[model samples]
Target chain A: MTRLVVLSAGLGVPSSTTLLADRLAAAVVRRLGGEAEGRVEVERVELRRLAHPLADRLTTGFAGEELAAALEAVHGADALVAVTPVYAASYSGLFKTFVDVLDRDALEGTPVVVAATGGTPRHSMVLDHALRPLFAHLRAVVAPTGVFAATDDFGDAGLDDRVERAAGELVALLSGTATTRTRPTEDERLADPTPFEELLRRAGAGPTG
Target chain B: MQLGIFSVGDVTTDPTTGRTPTEHERIRAQVAIALKAEEIGLDVVALGQHHNPPFVASAPTTTLAWIGAQTRRILLSTATTLITTTDPVRIAEDYATLQHLTGGRVDLMMGRGNTGPVYPWFGKDIREGINLAVENYALLHRLWREDVVDWQGRFRTPLQGFTATPRPLDGVAPFVWHGSIRSPEIAEQAAYYGDGFFHNHIFWPPEHAAQMVRLYRERFEHYGHGRADQAYVGLGGQFFMRKDSQAAVREFRPYFDNAPVYGHGPSLEDFTSQTPLTVGSPQQVLERTLGFREHVGDYQRQLFLVDHAGLPLKTVLEQLDLLGEILPDLRAGFAEGRPAHVPDAPTHAALVAARADQEVPA
Candidate 1:
């Protein structure tokens, strides 16, 4: 089963950022086996709810239950739809905070559809300026098309085209038809471990016989 | 199980009273706490090694030597000795000397120091942390066993036919525990050498610690140390207790809220529930402690962290008193299901006797 994680950094109950995320996720599911087919499972993470845990993690170096679960969901995701309301000309602080909580290589090679909702179309640059660079550093394969919905653009028909394009791009990458990335088989240095003798040899110390 | 107390030697402010202890007072307080541990019949007093301020245990050997002079039985150990930065030659000499001074009442834990600046300050590189731990410990292990060592490693200057002075007491090196907050290689290192692995069972969730222990145990058996369960394992935990659980919660709350490390983060209630932090009566502390066996299996050593985060010297002593009240019950609880073959935590006497039985240095 392909797990789709939608991370929305909207603070309001009826938030446009989450609405954009929902549209993108639904469009991707439609492109795949569809929601009724059950091949694609969607898990929505409201970054607003993770506020307290993120701050606590920053201070304590621990993830409480909710934050750990959200991180686990993201880690398991075959694809991601991240939607954040632009704040201070960038993705919401809550969105970045959640990103900060992730392990350095958590999203490596994962396909992502980046979207944002903003009060002004001028802040639309945030998708390229903020979210794109951030996910690039995390080594995610972001969809070629990124959706940016301004409050005014939300009513326009052009918005649907961008959301569908972004979803189609993500689905293509998720299905491995348009492959630009590989997860670089996990370095099993810790998982399976390098034998102690090899480590000693690498460190210029031979193993004791 | 060998029950003990380990201090990070944190000089923190008393949150409620707005009083920060002078480094001198905090340093002296550490001695008092260690002495109290012995006086109250606890088995060990382990001190942390930190090269930075806010932590004053840089010269732990000197402090442990002093504590050893005043005490008769309590073991002197390091919550961790900085194996990454400090020269292995120095560790070999100093700890062996400590073994002599303490009348063989010593065992030390090897740890890569957490502070990043410490590596550069000590003329080492931070990026070589695992390499340093691996190579340095390999050298220290030989320095203790081999009469004269010709050694070369990536992190340190080569030694040709060099002998570390004051070779380990009675020709039996002190047992070493490798400690790491979240490093897998350290667990593997501990297993490779058949050393004890200590998981600081605080700050993070218990499940994470369980995985680390599981990995160490599996590797220990693979390395031919013993059965996985027989591999030496030590756990670290923290608590604040009183006769009544409510009073314990009320008193520790203010300190838990504003003290360093975990302060101002998770609520006292949430922290206690998630981590192995028991903030309640002695019985509650005992109950939570026994639950550790369920996670890590039958174990060897258990170290509790106390006397940090600016809980006053008086309160720390009181916590020790409460710990003492439950020591019998705690030991009995640990002993009940533990098999007879599971070795007790290694000590100098035990090591010396074991060496005598083998008639060969290991």
Candidate 2:
């Protein structure tokens, strides 16, 4: 079974970003099957709830219980659906702060579906221009099709088509059938007990008179 | 177990009084705190090294050497000597001189300074912090153990046929403790050299300290040092005490609310419950400190952060008196039912005597 985690960086109770996240999560479940009978298990984390704790973590350099639980959910998920509200032509500050708190190598090879909600269609390119590159920097395998929901797109059939396509891509990735090639697992990529002899050799080959 | 105090030597304004000590006053207060530790029968006094504003303990060896001249029994150690930027040869020479002057009352804790600007100021790149720690300490280790050393390593000029004067006190290097907050590589390094591991047990929860100590102990045994239980471990704690717990809280709350490092974050109650900071009576401090062995197992040293967060020198000295009141109970409680195979914290005289034993016949 695949565990899917949805991270919504929406600041309000009924935020459009969170609405998009719920739709994406439901689409993932529907692609698997019905809700109770689906092979995909879903968990949702609202970064809005973690704003104060994230700020505290920034100051103290350690996570509180709530932030730690959110981080654990992200780290342990088989695939992640991240939805954020667009602000200043980029992801919201809260979304970026949450991402900043994660371990550098935490998302090394995980599959991710990036989505965003904005007031205008002009900000639609944020999915590729900002969110895609951010996840790419983290080494996450972002889906080729990113979903952007404008104020009017929420009730339109085109939004449904985009969600379905992105969710299908995610399911394919989870089932090991996606065209998106997988990166090496962390254990396979990292050299355990990093060869000390190589380190010594590097030390010996230093600048000298 | 060795019990004492460690100071970061921060020069913050006392929130209760809105007054900050002059740098000279703060430095002299640290010396007075060390002297009071000895007078109160504490075992060790460690000072931290910081090279920035709001902190004054940039020269720990010089401060410790001055304290050594005034005191007789208290162990003078650094909360951490920066191993990443400081030249290893200077470390070898200066610490040997300190060991000789103190008659072996000196041991050092090595740590990578966290301040980024300090790294470049000392001609080091913070990116190579772990590599610098690994290579610098490797050379520092050889300099003390071998008199005529031929060494070459990254991060420093090569040395050939050079001796780090003084040759250590009685041909025995000062005991070393590797201090770390989160780095597993440091734990491995400490274990590989059979040195002590110290967790700055103040800012974080017990589970974090337990996890780090467990890794160190497991690796210590894996490196053929000894059984996991025999690995030397030290922990740092912070406390505020009065005759009454309520008075203690009322007196320390202002400092807790406005002090640096942890203030303005978790509430005082929440922070105390989560970390090792105990602000209460002598009995309460003793109970919480004794509970440490429950998570990390039997350990050798316990150091407290008694003189930080802008508490006045008189208030800190009073806190030391409270510690002296409970010192006997703490030692006895920690000693109760401790396994016989576990080793005590290494001391100058004890280490020298152990070396002497190794050289003599059965």
Candidate 3:
């Protein structure tokens, strides 16, 4: 089964950020129809509900139950659709904080579709400037096509077209049709126990035997 | 089971009084606390090392040696001695001298100091913390056991024909406990050497302590030390108590709300519920402490944080009195139905006897 997680950093009920996230999730599900065969699961995490907990995490260095559940969902998902309301020409503080709280390697190699909603089309650059770079730092495979919705694009067909294109890119990556970015396999140098003999040798002590 | 108190040696203002103890006063108070531990029949008095302001315990061996001179039965130890930055040769020499001064009543806990800048202060890097610990401890382990050692490691200068002065008393090295809050490699290190693994059980939830202890035990058996249940495990706890539970909470709330480490984060009530913090009567403290065995299984040592967050020495002594009242019950509760094969916390006398047994003809 394919699990898709939607992270919506929307501050208010019926927020446009959540609306964008829902549209992206729906588009991905629509594209997954034949291959997924009703085996796709969608989970939504509203950062608005986790504001206080996120603050607690910053202070205490641990996540509360609800936030932990959200992190677990994200960690286990096959792909992610993250949408945030652009604040001060970038992703909202709440969105960045949620990402910051995740384990350093939690999102490694996970496919992600980055989207954003902002006041002006000029802020559309946030998808590339802010969101894409953040996921790239986490080693996530970000889809090449990113969807940005300004206030005026909410009800327009243009928004739907962009969402479909981004969702198709994500679906193609997930379905093994598109070439995803490659990451170096995890280092195994530390995996095995350094033989006691080798450790003694490094310490300039001959092997006891 | 061995019962004791460990202090981070912070100098903070008493929140209720808004008065801070001087560095001199705080240092003296630590010695007094150690004396009090022996007087009250406690087993151990461990102090932490911090090289920054608001913390004055930069030299633990010096302080412990002073405490050792005044106290007879109390075991002196470092809550943790920094292994990553400090030269292992100095650690070997200083602790060995301390063991001699105290008549072998010494053991030391190894930890990678937490402050980021402490690394650079000692001309080391915090990025190589785990490797430094692994290498430094391996060298330290050999220095104490071997009369002469030739050693080279990444963190410090090489040693040739080096015999650490004042060899460990009776030729039995002071017991070592690797103290780690979140590192699995540390647990593995302790297991590899058949040493003790101590989890500071006060800050986080019980599950974290359980997980670390479980790993240490599994790896201990993997190294052919013993059964998993026989692995040496020590846990740390924190508590503040009064005759009445409500009064205890009322009295400790101000200190808990403004103190360092956890002050600004979770509320007192929330922190107590989430961690192994008992702020109530002596009976309640005993019950909560005894419950630790349920998660981590039968363990060897139980240390408490009794004097921190600017509690005045008088109040800390009173807390010790309350602890003295409950120590018997706590000890018995932990000892009940404990298996015979499980080892007690390693002590000077026990180590000496084990060495004697080995030297004897089979």
Candidate 4:
């Protein structure tokens, strides 16, 4: 079964980010069709209300029931979607702290899609420099597709088509139809030295030399 | 030696007498602590964000941005920027604005919070935290890099020729360090991007912390970021300092014992010995911290927890003063002793230079 997990970090009720997450999940449900949905169980973990000590390590405590349950959901999930409010131009600390408590390899090999909501459209790079690096460090197979929703993007006047399109692409990526291109293999490395030159050398060089 | 100080943004009572301080006092004291960190020559001050009763700081970036305006040099950061529930678009925009406001002296650590009820409060499910982070960040990256992003993802709607305004300073994204304690997945996430990995080592023992960092360093190299040593790394710790080691332990015991987070658990001594909690003199604190490099290798940042346990702002300020005086020399000494092979902070200039070097001739 293709288990899906949705983690949300927004604070506002009727949050635009949360609405977007629902739409994303719905798109995934739609894309997978009845067959996939029947077998694919979808779960959600919201990290905003877990016990304080579990999230913040200043106090030595185990993961709270909420966080533990969320962790369990993550353990079984095949693909994940995470959303957060943009604060200080990155993921929220509450969100990051929950991530801090998880086992390092829990998300390995799992495909993931990311999204964020903020008042303005300025902090877009946070996905690359902050959030993406966080997940990539966890070893999850993240989709190249991501969605960023600005406060202005919400409401009937906007965001309808963009949400559907982003969600659809995410379904594609999660289903492996939009697999990220492989970095050239050793044989391919030497043959396709043109593109690999900087990346390989900058990556501290592979054994292919 | 990436010197870091984190503020839980709380006030505490005298641990010696088992007294509790007012929350208002704790909030004021956190500001003084950050200023003292700068004076002490710490590299970063990462403020945590929490909306619960005990924690006064709900908006970390607001504080960080304010700190950015006040502090001249110390890099301002958030201990964890929640990506799962918050909008990635807002994150992109706010941080970009922060970047401009701070003259590019800002960066952040991304995280998924622990609170489950927050999901429902925000009208999201508790199930898809990871997926949300993945999809949101993908769009955020495009918003920053591409002048016109035609992006579509599951967690957020697609963008057709959308361009996030107030673009990053010189089109260079802020440097990031992925922080985790137990989660290898977070470390792996950091490594895959060839970015920094931070292990909050205050609670875990040396071996566990070392193992996490080692995994990240190895995977960073695997993901083609850099040599293991060159991978940016950070660590978290808790410390209390006094001239007398006994005085340090004596003074910190009550706070440690009553701390809502760790209270009613392990004896203070046991916890201190088992984890990174160092209740000792300034010299001892320095020695213990210096030892971190032995296990973790040459790391990029080190953050300490000093503002929790309801420690009054005044006391926290004192701790900051002491840390400031001792830390500059510590950082300098570490730099002098560090091996030349280790990588340094991923500063904005480095990002610009790296990208410049990456450009294929137009």
Q: Highest DockQ among the candidates is held by which one?
A: 1
For candidate 2, lDDT tens digit of each residue in B251-334? 999999887998888788978887899999999999999999988999999999988889999999999999999999998998
Q: In candidate 2, what are the lDDT values of residues A60-122, reduced to their tens digit?
A: 778889898898778777889999999999999999999999878777778899999999999
**Interface DockQ per candidate:** 0.50, 0.33, 0.26, 0.06
Against the native chain B, what TM-score does each candidate's chain B reach?
0.98, 0.98, 0.99, 0.93
How well does each candidate reproduce the native contacts, as fnat? 0.58, 0.21, 0.13, 0.13
Task: Give per-residue CA lDDT, model 1, range B271-359, as digits (tens).
Answer: 88889999998889999999999999999889999987889999999899888889999989999978888899888888888878898
Higher-ranked by lDDT: 1 or 3:
1
Score every model by TM-score: 0.96, 0.94, 0.94, 0.63
Residue A122 error for model 3, in Å? 2.8
Consecutive 10-residue window with the lowest summed lDDT within model 4 chain B: B129-138
- lDDT (Cα, tens digit) per residue for candidate 1, span A36-116: 788788999998888999998998898999999899778767899999999998987889989998878779889999999
Which lDDT values do the candidates have, in the order given? 0.89, 0.88, 0.87, 0.73
lDDT at position B339, candidate 1:
89
Candidates 2 and 4, the one with greater TM-score: 2
Candidate 2 chain B minimal-lDDT segment of 10 residues: B182-191
Q: What value does the lDDT take at residue B78 in candidate 4?
A: 81
After aligning candidate 4 to the native by TM-score, how far in Å is the CA of B174 from where it should be? 0.9
Q: What DockQ would you assign to candidate 4?
A: 0.06
lDDT tens digits by residue: candidate 3, B1-362: 88999998999999999999999999999999888899989999999998999899999998998999998899888888999888899999999999888899999999998889989999987877777788899889999999999977666788899998888898989999999987777887898899999999788888878988888888889899899999999999999999999999999999998878778778887788888999999999999999999889999988999889899999999999999999889888988999999989889899889888888998
